[model samples]
Target: MSEPQHDVDPVRLGAYFALIEVSGLLRHAIEQQLQADGDLTFVRFQILRRLQLSPAGSRRMTDLADAIVFSRSGLTYQAGLLEKAGLVVRNRTPDDERGVTIAITDAGRALVDAVLPGHEAVVERLLFDRLSQDDARTLTDLLTPVRDHMRAAPPRSATPRRTRP
Candidate 1:
């Protein structure tokens, strides 16, 4: 039996590979900076950063998982680690006992503040410095729709999980 072929032109194929390569390289650099400056993994930094940016410095676990495109189980584990480090606190929502909200601590905010300068510098050096103003605008324009389209699918937290028999 032979595998079926789908049509993908060379230009699109090259663009896809280039995007993936660039994304991987950027993530590696960011991860190193996060680890060095804040003793954080990329996902943990993302979670902390998101909570830090929220007006109330907190967010529901499911919402956080969906926003960061992380699995709920993985986010829960990371949250537990953050909780242990005194960087964040988890509390059950008053309105919904089943729902948990994760809030950044003062320590968490301080850590984010400490790490941000290096993180910004690394991002500036690796990405922004390489792109012209117009190129940056165009890149954002091109990618925004793709991001929105992908996000239109149900978030992972909202998807039903399978049960074992």
Candidate 2:
């Protein structure tokens, strides 16, 4: 329960402080708004939004998981909840019987359609409206590298080594 001790390095500390504050505030605002108006968890909202806009209104489970950044079971579980809520349906794909597909239900589409504008407004107020056009472009340029970095699979947690004779 000890506090994390740090040898202060101004450059690193400044970077860490800025990152934590910005990211924490952004996520807090997003989660609060999503809970208030979306009637769905962040992950469910993502899945439903994707399926609602997807061609043929469906996508393979693996692809959906990838796009939504959830583990396979994590996505599947959330999809199950949506199905129980009549928001999405799971069916076996004819092309790949082994793979499942998810499609948004009409009600799901309606739900997202109703919520999307509010979501957009929240996003605009939190981010876009605060920036000028030129600043937005510059922000996009600065963010692209960070986006690319996230797309790469992160390294797995390290395992401890045992000494050998």
Highest TM-score model number: 1
Cα lDDT tens digits, model 1, 112-148, are 9999999999999999999999999999999999998
The estimated TM-scores of all candidates read 0.91, 0.79
Q: Write the per-residue lDDT of candidate 2 for residues 50-145, one digit (tens) a residue.
A: 998898999988788777667777888899999999999999979765789999999999988877887788778878888899999998898789
How well does candidate 1 score on lDDT at residue 64?
Answer: 90
Q: Which ten residues in a row have the lowest lDDT in candidate 1?
A: 156-165
Name the runs in model 2 displaced over 4 angstroms. Answer: 1-16, 154-165
- The TM-score between candidate 2 and the true structure equals 0.79
